[model samples]
Target: MRGLVWDGSELALVDDLLHRPPGPGEVVVEIATAGLCHSDLNPIDGKITQEVPVVLGHEAVGRIVERGPGVRLPIGTRVVLSVFRPCGACEHCRAGRRTACRRTAEPAATPFSRDGLPVQQFVRTGAFAERTVVSQSQAIPIPEELPDAEAAMLGCATVTAFGAVEERARVRRGETVLVVGAGGIGLNVVLAARAAGAGRIIVCDRNPRKHDIAVACGATDFFVTPEASDVAKACLDTVPDGADAAFECVGRADLLNATIASLGWGGRAVIVGLPSADTELSLRIRSLFHDKALLGCRMGSVDPRTALPELARRALAGEFSLTPLVTRVAPPSEAGDLIADLRRGELERGFFDLRGV
Candidate 1:
């Protein structure tokens, strides 16, 4: 099978990429489409450390072509991929801590190879290929009505946004919410806050071009500035008491600090962005005195196998916006190019249409 593989130094298309069949509690999915995200660049560009010769995608939607032992889903069932594979027996999984799953953090096994050598995985998933294997828990079935391109995003961006608002912040009705960085993920955060009935949703970003799109997604106001201090001030002024919840979707230390400062008394700032490895933010320690909380978000704290179906129902009901998030679709040949686009902030959300391959 053909796949985009990244060695330690460069990315290249390899036609001999191979994946083994489903083992116990695993499923093999034929890729329909896979979404390209900013985090996908982490390994290839050394933004994050990862094993080399790995397939480079996680956010995707595909149909199950085979199932391993104990798997119940029938073949041909369409599903959204969840990159995190929790070892159900571990302490974290038993407590429903999906994101903290032990297996996802530390690699356990590789399912792919080329030239009889292992091809490492990114985020416990390697969906950038024609077919890939994943734990059964990582597969979430979706309704037939969900578009393939849109459903691909459910694996990461959508789930992460939903998790950030609902799990990390517990945003409730009539509260003021602020979302920093109105990119694909940030826009979803705005929409999620709106669905939760936030009285006012303020978005901050350097690009004024994204203001309209952010507003369309649920931003009641926007702060268009590159300076974090200026953006925070705008957000604070928009909500006199301070924002009830703020999401830092830009993975920069300065923006994260700004998001934390934008909070009102007892406000929560959830870091939803993936920052560089070993990166740390310097913040005002005294800020916590207002009962303000700073928290990190992972996959929106969502259990895809359980939560995806309901989210899909809400999406199908027009409660969540997906179309606006999906800006383009490209072939796998452009996978590397899309990664470059993601780094350049030129794409909202895009997918690799692997069905043609």
Candidate 2:
């Protein structure tokens, strides 16, 4: 089988990789499409920790090729795989926390091999390969009508963006919302806020190319970060008392601090982006005095079982367009350059079209 493997040195295609069959309570998935995300570049760039020589895809949709003992799902079921590997029985999962499931963390043992040497599974679910074996719990069955490329994004971008706005920020109808960054995740935040009937949707980004979709996705106002006094006046003149909720999707401290300041007295600022492990964020000490709050949202603060279905239903209803957000659909062999473009903020979302392989 072929897969995108990273050896802690560089990321590229590995031609001679192998996939083990599913064990009990597991399923082997034939991945049809996988979305490339900024987070995927973190390990290769040493921004995040990942075991070397591991298969690195985490957001994808596939068909169930086989199932292990006690697995009830029939073969050929189309599914969206969740990046969060919740064990269902762990304390966190038991409490319905999607952050981490104790036993879901990749163990020292992995089912992959490259030229006879053991390789790790990047996030316990390595969907970069032609096929991946994962616990049955990770697969969420969706209507077969959903497109593969778009379904692949539901596992990451949509969940992170929509979920963060709807859940973390708890945005209410008639309220004002501000989103920083207009990339994949950022755009989704705009869409979700619109769906919630936000009165004003403010988006800030340095890229004007995103303005079209930012508006299409429900951005009522857009700004070019560097020049426009638009962002500064947004909290001062636009909403008067500031936006009801602000989402920081850029993962930078400076912007996050600014988002915090751009909130109203009782506004909530949700951290939807992942920053460095050691990055520190600060704001005026008095910002929190007026009932203002800053929150950390992990995996959009959603339960995959429920959130994925809701997102899928909304997509099927034509609430939003997915393919329009995609910039490219290419074979997995081009993973290197495409993924680097994502790291450099050059692409919104690109998918590895692996169905033909």
lDDT of 1 by residue, 1-357 (tens): 998899988888788988888899999999999998888888866887687878989899999999999999999999999877777888878887777786766665889999999998778788888999988888889999999888888778888998899988999999999899988899888889999999999988898888878888988998787798887889877777788899999899988888888889999999998889788887779987799999987788867777788888899999976898888899888876787777676778888998857
- Report the lDDT tens digits of candidate 2 across residue range 94-179: 78775656565546357788778888887778888998888888899888878888899898899888878888888999999999
Model 1, residue pairs in steric clash:
163-300
lDDT computed for candidate 2: 0.83
Residue ranges of candidate 1 with Cα displaced over 4 Å: none
TM-score of 2: 0.94
C-alpha-based local distance difference test score of model 1 = 0.86
- What are the RMSDs of all candidates, in order? 1.5, 2.0
State, as a TM-score between 0 and 1, how close model 1 is to the true structure: 0.96
